[model samples]
Target chain A: MPAVSMPIAMSELIVRLQQESPIPMDAELRCTGGQLLALVGPSGSGKTTLLRALAGLVQPRHGYISCSGETWFDSAAGHYLPARKRRVGYVPQHFALFPHLDVLHNVMSGMLHRAPETRVAAAHDLLERVNLAGLESRKPGQLSGGQQQRVAVARALAREPQVLLLDEPFSAVDHATRERLYGELAMLKQSLSMPLVMVTHDLREAMLLADEMCVLHRGRTLQTDKPLELVARPVSADVARLVGIRNIYHGEIAGHAPEHECTQLRFGSIVLKTPYRPELVPGSRVQWVIPSDGVVFHRRDRPSHTERENQLQGIVDTVHKLGEITRLAVRMEDEDRSLLWLDVPSHLARRNEIAEGVTATVSLTVAAIHIIDSTS
Target chain B: MDWQALRLSLLLAVATTVLLLPVGVFAGRWMAESNFRGKILLEAAIATPLVLPPTVIGYYLLVGMGAHSPVGVWFTELFGRSLVFSFSGLLIASVLVNLPFAIQPAQRAFESIPQDVRDAAQCCGMTFWRSLWAIDLPLAWPGVLTGLTLSFAHTLGEFGVVLMVGGAIPGETKTVSIAIYDQVQSLNFEGAGSMSLLLLLISLGLLVFANVLGRYAGRLHAYRNV
Candidate 1:
């Protein structure tokens, strides 16, 4: 029998799936009610599979999935709850609305658990809540991608579920629609009482909406923390790469400068200063990263204080404009071939006359430089 | 025109269509949904009627329904009669001979249904029967109708299986096709030619209906893709 009662003690979703067969995963995740937890990973990293497992759409060969104290799946005791029985609202990537049904019936279809008379009114109310009130009579195919995504969310909400799972729900929409949907999702998230787990490959998307993020790699959950921390302090070089840190490079501990409240590192052909780590022995090889936020573009017109430490002269390798910001890839003037990535406001690049094949100086914030374990 | 033969042929076609409705639906759906290792082999087996000669099917049906066969003996003990050369036997032969027409288009229709739509139906808390009725049937009804029309057209014109299983017994097994053959043999060229032309027009009409339904099913699948 499927577990129906929500335990009072089980207020949050806790999942642990570990096995080698069928979709292999060693993922464990937690999210309190009303919080949005983003499962961030690259493609084929088992992010969607993990979300499906949570929603009871995919069963792990071995695992325990519990939400609000109900044991939805426990492989040891051989307990399994099928997808429908679980109070989960899953919004698939494509927003698989019933094509034969109009938008109103599509939302009402998921309201089967509610009273018959209340369902229609409830569906109307949900459609209204999702800002789709006028489109209640339209079919899914007639709606725009953003509108379709809204209907999918409304349908999921009609279930009155304990947990909501969205699999890259806004990916199909245009960029402008995505920007609008992001704001709408942020608003909707504030009103949701259930925990929402969203799977996304874009860390920027996760950072924009998720309260906490769980970084996944090769089917294993690597780190779970606030999105900013995951970006600034990844636990290993492998995760640093996964989080899209492009400045990770080989370095060695030069020596500790206790009086300066920092430590020195031997970067390729140069010495750089970072936050003090007295525990590290000098001459030990290590991997380090500087957060993109820490990379400051130096200009002749303006003076900044922290630019004094780790000032490096590099040739701008490439410059690509992205709306208001210009993404710059700078190859440092050293034996190292790796390029450092920086995103500055578009006007900053134009004002500084920065472009490809031009020389530039940048400051790697001492406090933002992080050392990571070499082992995965 | 042998009106009794025509009437018997209409009865056989209608019976074949009605009887094969559920069989075609379930089998076609199974073929569409199943991914077992032997699925391809099973599909080929089900398609044998399309490629095999009607006489081969008729001969096998004759052998399997003879008194010495277990089915024949069991059927006789149950129904107090032999299995061959009767309207019931002809109906059975029609259904078997029309399997390909009744199943292939329907299977293609069911297969065209996006799997994610089925997943969404299940996720909506709809049971398997509910989804099949409310979702799968709605999406696949056009293809199913195509199968029925194709089967009806094919059943209206079947001759070899009818000849082998149900011999020319007027009002019992002698269908319009066999009646036309008998008319030609007796040198009644006018009667035979008129009946053949009428059958041709009816089959043409049904084929056109089936083609329209098939295209409608294709459009439904295309809409889902969009």
Candidate 2:
């Protein structure tokens, strides 16, 4: 009785695609039920292509896509379902609301097969859910950008699709409106139990709304991980940069301790420690990144009592005041003459009298030093 | 005043416009959305009527519909009459001369619709025909209307092709333009002047109405995008 009473379990989605035109797409992605996955990349990086392929708007020459136990596309089997039969709710970058249809009709347009009364009732209920309760008769052209987008979302949800795809859904609105929409989306995500995939070019947007982040570059999946993990331990320097990491240095493996599972890396004259991998042998070159938040800076006049494992003295090459934060570019006084970027609160910079010519003591915490494999 | 010639001309124009609507929409949407080999050649072929002299097209139609030709023989056997010098002959010639006017503007309208709009309609479970009816037709309505009006006006003024095929037969094949030409030949300047003025006023009104509608449609499209 308990087994029969359980809700229907949502099936996992798997997509592998390869194509060459309209911006080549070579990506493999997976998402489970109740999870929001963000596909992020630069412009022309095939993010939209991948989303379209999943929605069956664009077909790949070689691919296999299955969602909720349905084989939407399988090139090896020569099976392909058209977009009309895919049951996907896609909110394109421009929202793409029907201009001639009123808000209620736009929502009801997706429910054409249902009874007339049911479609009207469902559309009104959806409009209410999206906080557009009384504007049902207003056409999309008469509404503002945010209101139209809300109508678009309501229209998409009216069909009750198994998968929801949003392509840069909030990029069209102003920043203030985007923040409110983000909160609204977060609240909406709680009730929706389907797999949602959002394509975005903004790293902050991805970190704010997505449960997992997938970074793409040149039509290839660079890395996929939790937002924090992607920021801390990117698989490569390119991935680190794409995720907004500012501090990266070229280093070489100086020593490897098999007993302790740690590796010593040499960057110029500074020796850093990191969790070792079997592939990183001594004398091999590597690229490494240290998140700006992980770098501890102390005034040279009053040094802190923290451990000095990877301490270095450097001159502040430049100081950039960005709102409440100050970014300092430090030039190391070591043999490599490497430059390190650090972000400090503006109040702290003012209190410490940190200026472009000031000398500062910075420490690179061993646990935060991430060595990325260059082969990828 | 040759009211029968005026009525025949109006019938020919209306019939040609009504017949060209479906063909124009189909061809316009296809050319706007598709990329194929020899696309340029296909486009040029469709637009040849706009650039080539009307008499040249009339000559070809005359030869092609002559009794010796296959189409002429089939029509004669089927309808128990000759294919030349008839209202049907004038209608076909008018449609051929005005084909580009019906297609080019409609194609521009279809092309103006963003791909996202089509994709959004598809994602909503609308089939190709359903979307065309619900989204494409409505969004591109102004341009389609302009094309139809232009075709109607173009067919109303047709002289060379209709004269060649229909041969100016009074009450059966003669149209308003032929009537006006006949008046001019007989030194009846007053009749020719009145007919020409009527046509000028009608064509101007249709064009102005289409321009206003097209501008309104463009604004509507801009609002949707914004």
Candidate 3:
């Protein structure tokens, strides 16, 4: 039989949007199968609301959700299954560990009713897997925050769920601990073979863990695609800004020169080349996305011939050291009044001694110049 | 000194706390989670018994339990019993009067729990019963304990309600508090002094015990929320 004939049924999720404004608004959507997807948005963006709705905790005015093809909620059908029957594992941001139960008891609680005696040993195995082996007998109050979160993760997995929802799981942990947990989670996802949905505000985390990233704004999914693609080629300026693209330029397409195989953008006296197909006639509004890392710093006179894509004369207005990288805020003379932030590696920054008030030539490769779909 | 009275008092107190445990837990959960209109009014009403004179409650109970009343007739037919001047009547009165002692502390404890904890439990697909058993009950036990101790001790010291309903029936409804009052009324100095001392000591011991339990429970909640 073909793989399609023996296809494993995927979870069907749907949500309807309708709410008074200010924060995440109402929206409707349906997703199938257990896809490792990341819901990335800023604070108050409604990522948490979507997670809760899927979990059956927040019942919208109207929506339907089916897990693994099992109909759990249908407002039209008047079918509603409580969270317990939904059988989804939800790991909250705080990882609510039972205070009265020890680590072993906490993990075992998931399987308590179905398999009573197996819980103790299963808990031990899970604890050991999460790197809390000997600490199973210890109460949650005795454990550190990271350890408690690990215990919470172990508990959620004990149920052997098909779908797992994580809400900002690493937000509370230190950088080193978060890295370690992320590695653990990746390993767990491989073995679980389940759709793991995560809500995150951190761009790095979304990029690292998400198979597909959904960018939500005011409760609507603005863009959904592979993680790297969202950053390298955003759907719009809002998405580019959300993904931390610090350089955005507004200009008009001056002309399309077939000989150059590029479109010429006119901003004041400077002309920049964009690799995007010239889709409009001359004098159409357009925006350019240049990531901070794409902007290279060099003395106005010293430059490479290979970097002949987009060059602009700008003064280094400010410079600040940020860990392993140096951040430079450059002011370009454009009618749009946009500021460009360029990130230089610490070693390169030190060698070049880039500082404020230094006149520098900002060069961007045509490949790095991403054309954003204009709102208008 | 009056063994029958002493036994009656102890019986009423223990019975009241035992009866109110489930009620206290239910009320605590309700008040903690529910956000309805008149919620504060309901809470104030529940705590009214604690502040109002016990005699006023006793007077209402006496009127309601009168042989001609509807409640009295229902009780008569259903249980083949009349409540006035009976030991069971005192037990019922004590449980009703001291309910707030148990419920108020339990509610406060349940309220102290973070919403994140409840949301976490809900997210795990744990049903209402399972969440209550596995999370809410355990987390709120310290508060329950506080309510239990207070209700029991308060019930033991009740004189007004027991006097009005149970009366001074020897070997049946003559609780220690009532007996002490009777002794003082009759000028039985020795009997009054001895019974009063015992009641005072027992109540003092219980208060001390509750203080220790409260401290230990505080530590437990702190430990778990970590």
Highest-scoring model, lDDT = 1
Model 3 has fnat of: 0.67
* Reference-based TM-score, model 3: 0.90
Stretch of 10 with least lDDT, candidate 3 chain A: A1-10
Model 1 vs. true fold: TM: 0.94
lDDT of 1 at A92: 91
Off by over 4 Å in 3: A1-35, A112-114, A117-125, A305-308, A346-353, B67-69, B76-84, B119-125
Per-residue C-alpha lDDT of model 2 across residues B183-214, encoded as one tens digit per residue: 99999999999998888888898889888978
Candidate 2 clashing pairs? none
Please state the error at residue B2 of candidate 1 in Å.
1.4
User: Model 3: how far is A322 from its true place, Å?
Assistant: 2.4
The parts of candidate 1 lying over 4 Å away from their true place are A1-9, A279-281, A301-308, A318-326, A333-337, A345-347, A350-358, A374-376
Model 1 chain A is weakest, by summed lDDT over 10 consecutive residues, at A1-10
Best by TM-score: 2
Instruction: Note the DockQ of each predicted structure.
Output: 0.73, 0.81, 0.57
The model with the greater lDDT, 1 or 3, is 1
* TM-score per model over all chains: 0.94, 0.94, 0.90
Chain B TM-score (model 3 vs. true structure): 0.94
Write down the lDDT that model 1 would get: 0.87
